[model samples]
Target chain A: MVMDTKQPFEKLVELHGATVLRVCRAVVGPGEADDVWQETFLSALRAYPELPADANHEAWLVTIAHRRSLDSVRAAGRRAMPVGEMPDGRSPLGNPGPDGDGVWDQVARLPDKQRRVIAYRYLADLPFADIAGILGGTPAAARRSAADGLKKLRTLMAETPPQGGTP
Target chain B: MTSTDRTSRTGPVDLAFAPHLTAIEPGALHRLRSALAETATREGVLDIAYRIVDSPVGQLLLAATDRGLVRVAYEREDHDAVLQQLAERLSPRILEAPARLGSAAAQLDEYFAGRRRGFDVPLDLSLSAGFRRTVIQHLEGIPFGVTESYTEVARAVGNPKAVRAVGTACATNPLPVVVPCHRVLRSDGSLGGYIGGLEAKSALLALEAAP
Candidate 1:
């Protein structure tokens, strides 16, 4: 018997788009987040019905965005600087006021592996198992990496001198 | 409030990263919906059927034409809004028929089941042209379980310096999933920006990378 397996796409968007966008922003920075977000959904639309019902769909889309975001960043590097380097003047972890530049700076300073893992597991809020797959490691390894990265971040935070504190 | 006061309250780290953490505004959703609806309602166009396809992450509102699929939206109450937008942007002929999208819908079903890898469907990409089309066309070549960087895609398309433009094209991709835009990544192997949201993007990448 043929099942009437028609799933509504609107519901999926409402439920998942916000979470997906959050993760994308964290992974790639806001400068190029929206582009990746749009591309992710477009890819989903074409492949939705084929997606395994039992499979973790959220993980699937996040993986796609991650790869795409990475591609864009690499592409930006190959292209002529898009009008000054990525505003490196800002402090890596200082408050940039309402603009969020400070947080982004800190995130940028993170080693590539630590940054990707942290962004995926913490900022993007993905599970370690899923993060592992994205990073091509075991779930346990991914979790350990994330933990180590977070620990280092906390250390970095502690070591940072207060703005007005004596050197 | 003064910058100093703001910094003191949220703390320097919080203040610096707060903007990046801020969610997409509800107004943007409203505007996107409105824009899509307007574009779907333009005059003199043929039927622009739309439907919502439920997936693992969220609902995907897909709009199509007799020629092929046109637009796909994520998370909006009024799917018709995008259809209307399409109508306004191009020509009005939007309708609603699941049967018309039989081939696409079928392929999608197979893909979700993990029974399929790529799609084989005629597309209607009147919304994009020139460099955008070139970028998307090359994007299709990215095999499942494999990925390429935006710069790589640009070079493949014969314009290495257009990597940024390639990214812009990806951002503006009118037909996303079918074109496999999610397979692109950074040279450093980090996730990138996505319009449908990064979670979904990551989800797609994860699915591809899964054993």
Candidate 2:
């Protein structure tokens, strides 16, 4: 019965790991999502013991994920020296839009705050308060960002023809 | 699925694109687990990496902390139960991934194969404390192929009259075969009860006694 003790950390990973992955991917694009996700959980595991038992587990993990995403972006910015010709801004999602994972491409085109609020609110299903807690704003601002982000995403989706379609 | 967990406010947002969002990140979890282990070992925070090896006696459970080998268990001790005990005693942040146990396992392999007499690997004896810890430490000094009585072990630990307490310590020896608790026998030159059962005690002694 001792083994049946609080394994909340492993359970935390099992529950929200995928959503955290998507949140990071949405924020920083796929090329860096893996590192950021790993960092987020590693930090979570390190601090897990001291965490309050009554805390919101999802918000806590996403908060960690949010910080790690910024760290990866900063690190990549420093290491991003000039290389060969840059790819077209069109391929920002780092994959072919025709693959029908174009949601990522559209999500990639969104402004940073809108992208994160959408990922946290819709994709990860965090409430506006948790999203605001993670991204730092009032809950009303979180809700506004979600609405604005969704409105822009709809416009983009409507006007942009599918990449492989006859035009 | 929607009735209980994962319930969320869809609000007024269109969600036709939710599938791509919820689609699992391929191989991301595996990468994260590996990263966790690597960073934990590197950072020395709640690291609980372990490995298992078949011995001349039985399959042994080998676990290491950030410092060194922390535990060794016999097959009869139930390796799963042993791991859980470790999880309880230490942290549940354990993985059976065998990351930092290479040297310890190889030394144990050599000891079993009769190539080495004394262990050269570091030990994490945090599991033992106070009198029991001191008794076990004295047991480690008894040498390979040599035997000591529990009274002598008690005396070696500067507690000559604590014989029964010494037996209690040996009975609860967390590292067992690796720490050589089996080398402590009855003062009348007889095998006493071993945490690993008497036969394992005899096997270890016999294995060491072979010339």
Candidate 3:
């Protein structure tokens, strides 16, 4: 399986690297997400020989990414820790402020599944079907999970009073 | 604190973070490509060099390393910014040498000339990881002229709910032309935001869509 000639795979990296990273970040947190992403691609490279020539490569890669993210979460024992700094080098947990309106902090407080789903669906903007495939559920189920998570977030946002309110 | 004082405090807090969200600049784009080439050449690892080419809409900067073409940039962005970004995000040593990027530049020239449809160049995407890499990989599948919805891209990547994050990736695309970030659009068929500006996006789309 001399698959070293697959130039399209390189193109695939240029095109979808950001998308993959976003999903990994959402699921595994930003710090540990890169390791998972690298592993996913490394696996993809190893399995490239076996992939059907005409198969949807993007779909295949995503499936691998989903599994890797889940594995990363499990391996970390769901510690609810923040990933490392963002690409801009900003801290993931966010710098605390006087009124405590740091968006990252609010995001961190979310339940693990909900937080991952929100980052995946909203922040990453992946389709429900793809998310479901990664999460090991039907598309509808994925959508429901995302919706439920969003509802919880809305509630959190609502409950937090605006700083320096009249009341 | 008084109610008015509280309101005033919150306002500045929000504003303080706003500056960090500034858009990419053109000068930074030029500097980045130059720096990347220089560093790569200095290390003797850059087999290819990059040159800044002018297109109808904006400047196009390309990078070629020993492995292949490593990056592309839009005219409106700062080359230094892009280079610094790559250095900070990926590595510290990027060099400048047009010969290293000659092959990529040739292909890109053909693309601009309407003689070529797709790119065949070596890439070094070591700058990003995780969801960002996923998004960039997906962008590669978009054909030269055809476009896909952000949602479709998300679905393709196996996380159908990540549309917003997908958009962010597009906005944050480090290698614009090479990755073809402009090809991704809104699900509703509208042109989406581009770090290079809407006009430049429109121009690229038009070039691809042309017969």
Candidate 4:
């Protein structure tokens, strides 16, 4: 039945705001996620009116966020900051507790492709097919990237060990 | 695994790791919403701002342009559909920025509580035009607690033959309750059609009739 009603831009924000924030934080770091989020949504709001009624808003939002994150990444690369140091002191995941640093540090250490695959797969809850549509390559390749990312992440976490644990 | 649809599945990542990635800072969403509203306004793209208000009648959808209060919708009117309609007719750059409609919401609260008799907020009136606009403008002059027949309004608008047209105007009034469309009744003193349903119309009339 082709329902052509376009919801208010606010509805889109309410529905996907958190997921997009997580995607932004994962693709970029937590320190820069908010800015990327703002840019992504501003762009979305500007183009929302013209979007086809039945288009998948979630996928569309993630695509915009992915592009914006890439832009910021390129911008940061041009600046040529020292490796292994965050621009800010905040934990990678914005986790404040002592135990959080190890988990997010490993995530931040991941190669860009793995980091994004894990993010889009777990955080955004997008299918591999959709993730491939955003990131390029086939659905199988996207799945493989996510699997490799998870395996690598688990290994890193195992090596790090939790801070307050039984000796 | 290729045969299985992956859309319905979750990632193999352990549940414990999920929280680390999804943890949102306190006030993050609040800050985002405020920032979006501000940016949209500053960019001159917030074409229509809307908010919801609770009243003796029901939840009312109050929408305004920079010009002033543009739409006052009843719950029965389907607020979502109303917003979509507004998006189509007006610009699609609408946001839930309450500040623009703050005055209108406050006025409605006062009116429903019987503390205020008439609304003083600026109105866009662009939604209604020609004969409908003329009829709606005449409806504003309708004093509180006083009811006028559609026939009377038709003659007052200088078109005695447009009685049915007057009813049509009142039926399509974008801003009900505030516009006093409930004040217009059938010539036989029977309740006529209301965009907000007959019960809402009766509730509005009863609210006004109160001492």
- Best candidate (score: lDDT): 4
Clashing pairs in 4: none
List-wise, what DockQ does each model earn? 0.05, 0.28, 0.01, 0.36
Task: Indicate whether candidate 2 or candidate 3 has the larger TM-score.
Answer: 2
B21, model 2: CA deviation in Å? 4.4
On lDDT, the stronger of 1 and 3 is 1
What share of the reference contacts is kept in model 1?
Answer: 0.09
Q: What's the CA error at residue B6 for candidate 4, in Å?
A: 15
The digit string of per-residue lDDT tens for model 1 on B1-211 reads: 2111222332222323334443365554444333333333343122566767887657877777767788767663345556546755654434444555667877877876678899888778888889998887788788888989988988899999998898889877776667778788877888776757788789888877777
Best by DockQ: 4
List, residue by residue over A1-167, the lDDT tens digit for candidate 4: 65667778887888788778878877777777888999888898888878998889988999999999878876675676545544422223332333545556767767788888888888778889999999899999999988888898788778885443312
| Every model's TM-score on chain B | 0.74, 0.80, 0.74, 0.89
CAPRI docking class of candidate 3? incorrect
lDDT string for model 2 (B1-96, tens) is: 222224244333324443445445356566776667677677766567877888878888888877788888888888877776776678767765
The residue-by-residue lDDT of candidate 3 on B1-211, one tens digit each, is: 1111111222211223221111122353344334434543554543334567776767777765456656677767877566555544443333445666667778878888899888888777765579988999889778888899999989999999999999999998867877889999998889989988999899889998887
Per residue, candidate 4 scores C-alpha lDDT tens digits across B55-159 of: 877899999888988999999989998998998778677889887777888888888888999999999999998999999999999999999999999999999
Worst 10 residues of 2 chain A by lDDT: A88-97
* lDDT per residue (tens digit) for residues A1-167 in model 2: 22244453455666777667767777777777777888888888888767765677778888898888877755665577544433323323333222655566776777778878887887677888888888888999988988888888788777774343321
C-alpha lDDT values of all predictions: 0.63, 0.75, 0.61, 0.82
Task: Tell me the TM-score of model 1.
Answer: 0.45
